[model samples]
Target chain A: MQTLDQERTSAPPKQIEDLSLLGEVSHRTAGVSRLEMCIQCGCCGGSCPSEADMDHTPRMLFAMLRAGMRHAALMSNTPWICVSCYHCVVRCPQNVHIADVMYTLKSMAIEAKLYQDSTAPDFSQTFVDMVEEFGRSFELGLATRHYLKHFPLRLPNMAPMGIGMLSKQRMNITPTRIKGIAQLKAVLKRAKEVEAAS
Target chain B: MNKYILYPGCSMESSARAYYDSLKAITDIIGLNLQEIEDWNCCGATEYLGIKLTPAYALISRNLALAAQQADGTRTVVAPCSACYLNLAKADYYMQEQPVLGQHVNEALAAGGLSYKPGSLDIRHLLDVLVYDVGLDTIKSKVVRPLTGLRVAPYLGCMVPRPDYEHRWSDYEYPVELDRLLNALGADVIEFPLKTECCGGHMTQISPDTAFELIRRLVSAADEHQADLMATLCPMCQMNLDAYQSETNKFFHTSYRMPVIFFTQLMGLAFGLEAKDLGFGLELVSARNALAKIGIEHPAEIPTGTARPKKDGSLPMPAPLPRRNMHTEKGKVVK
Candidate 1:
């Protein structure tokens, strides 16, 4: 396993076919991802609201997965671009769980440290950190930290709306911690253990 | 009164407080006995599910476990937020569908001295409960001040209807549940093609350009259809279209003032509840002009200078569909 820094700086690895890629993604998904059942029908791509922003459409990414192009599959920005709207999941002729499959691919990419963009992963991490800490999401804190780190220039533009939210009391200045934070944290910790064991 | 467990998500406490407030007022009028699950944590939203599967499912199921424990005589758990509803429903559905996943999640729950049987609880959205359980006839009977001429674009967003594990929707592409409910309240429901379309979700936080274009599409479509305002079921949809409308305008160099609000707020209005009680002025884009059509003006709403467009020169919009006389059969609403 290459370090994340090395993986980013080094030249692309030779395309050695990893035949388990499709099944691996399927296994990681909570329910049957049905990734192997994809017919490349383009329904997923056609129905995707964010297809224009993705490097490869979901259909193309599935084709890559079938070809065992693990490096390419993990590096593509398609999964991160998916908003999990499930438009493709309902539209797919084969009943493929396209959105859940995207989640599996995202974790895999994060595990391999092969994704091209860090914006989505970092955002997800920031959100999860707040959830772990307070047992609930802190929108004000999350937005502040996220904008300051990623889009410092856009902070001024975001101020008017922030002030409106604050003045109207739509968002709280301090995060509200849940009553069962200790219990919730224990469950999360044990969940990680179970995942590792599996 | 029909009773159930209410899983008001984290947003209900913060950004979506209007939804929470309106829900409280309307539930009293509609006779929905909603008992909140005690000490429930967040459902992990769409974020944790992307990072790790087991932990994410476990985190969401923690709420399910709590709701299950607190399920006195009611097996039903209702969530008002679309993302929260989807996550909770997905966890229950997937746990039953894949027993191995359920077993692993239960292992995590053991640490917290909790275990939830996958199929023991029924997860439903608050809209589903309002329409199906409470019945449209009941909702109509309570309308003291009908929203007669208010043209509303009933936006359900994506999460509420799609991948509907329980087959609870009218149609995935264009669900008429919200349309019919609004019509019952006397709003002129518009022909909104992007009703089930994505409202950019978390893209506003991760990628503003991508999110802005999506928001622009929904808002522009609602405007083209000549909707006075867009009424939505999800707080995220309300926030994105309401809070981010100006930013989207700046990005696209277009001025579109479409006030996005929660459906419950509108329902509260139709039921003769005070605007303050229904969280009328909290929206970033003021709904004053829209409500003014029905002779209901919010005190805190600042007046906008933009004149309403004359309907003559623009190509005629397709007439809004006739109101459906709906009846539920085996948990599915049919016209």
Candidate 2:
């Protein structure tokens, strides 16, 4: 039933256009990510606890990367859905650094402005803003501001828990700035400059 | 006594104050001498790393640099929080693995008048220090009150074990370090396959549905095992399971009350320390009922040859897997 004629008539594989995508991700990942060693194994997808929430499995995302589907890959919710549990990283037969690569994809998505939803990115940005400002995370402020911007209706529901945590002295109402705030800011400022230059 | 520099992460001062309090209550008994790293900032906790590379590493490296400078007689830096432990260890490992990263991070640190040479300090989790350094035999000897009937499910969460760059954990997927430690405290540690599962991390804020589902699974698993309570080492895991249990139940339309608490609190209980001093009532989900299961007197021993025969056609339950000894000296430091 299988004939050489059918094989000859079949279309050729799509040419990989965005070859820099893999290089960029691997380079951005810390240490040797081993992204190039991926063998299309579905271990990363299978091991992911949050795979149900992802629009594309890591394996599928890798395929898309190979096919040079930059827009589709960047817009996919796969990277954002990652919990960074490292389950896939350990389970990957090829030893691919799946979780770290997800981090890279997230930063790249933010850079290209190709993310489908603003919730995760906004949370990360807000968290970063708090860290940059006070050198510590103010959970109450983070929750209040994030909920006000995204889910105002849920604020009323969250009040009881907030009151409980506050009354229990579990969370501080105000942020605590570290003593070396000025020093940390200088280090971070220099880090940003170096990152931008590289 | 073994000495180590303590890096009590941001959560210790905030959402996980109970962990800090209970840890302090038991340290003297276990002989863990902790000198807190002064003016230590947050490790950027799983967020800043994704936003920027060099700055995030620099932020974590600052602590390492501080620890290195502050290391008097001890070169071991112990972090109680799982996220803090992983971040510190990862920064150290990566900086050593890739010299270019070390150069960039050091360049940034130079701006702060600080520089860290990779592999200078031993970055370890508090749990690791307790099991490996303090030894379970010593912990058992200090137990004046045994948690005999209270069944506990040990939850380590993510971050702590996986991506073990230094090869510290016995098995990345199913490490038994926490389980063995809890067993030493006289609690009936259950067979919890979801021990190392993710607690949805920050998804509790970004996507409530995702976090709820994951939390529901963990709670449901413990309930299925007939666990009286769940014990966790990570504050994030405890917060997600305890603070969000009601939300998870509501989302699933199920009425299940599962109490989640830190391992240190249980350790304090076993050491005969008062519950109030260990920060018992701070958990959103009340751990009172679970704590009540600890009887004032030990139960009388059952006579031998009183075993009931299995019913016809009833399948035999599989035996529990043996816990591996992860105390090997290998992989203590990566060269």
**Per-model lDDT:** 0.88, 0.86
Listed in order, each prediction's TM-score against the native is 0.91, 0.89
Expressed as tens digits, the lDDT of each residue in B172-220 for candidate 2 is 9789998889889898999799999999899989888789878988999
B17-106: candidate 1 lDDT, tens digit per residue: 889999998888889999999888878888999999999999999999999998999999999999999999999999999999999999
Q: Give the per-residue lDDT digits (tens) of candidate 2, residues A77-184.
A: 899999989999888999888887888888888989988789889999999999889988889888888989888887776666677788778789999999999999
Can you tell me which runs of candidate 1 are displaced by over 4 Å?
A: A1-17, B301-335
Name the lDDT of candidate 2.
Answer: 0.86
lDDT at A40, model 1: 87
Residue B136's lDDT in candidate 1: 97
Candidate maximizing lDDT = 1
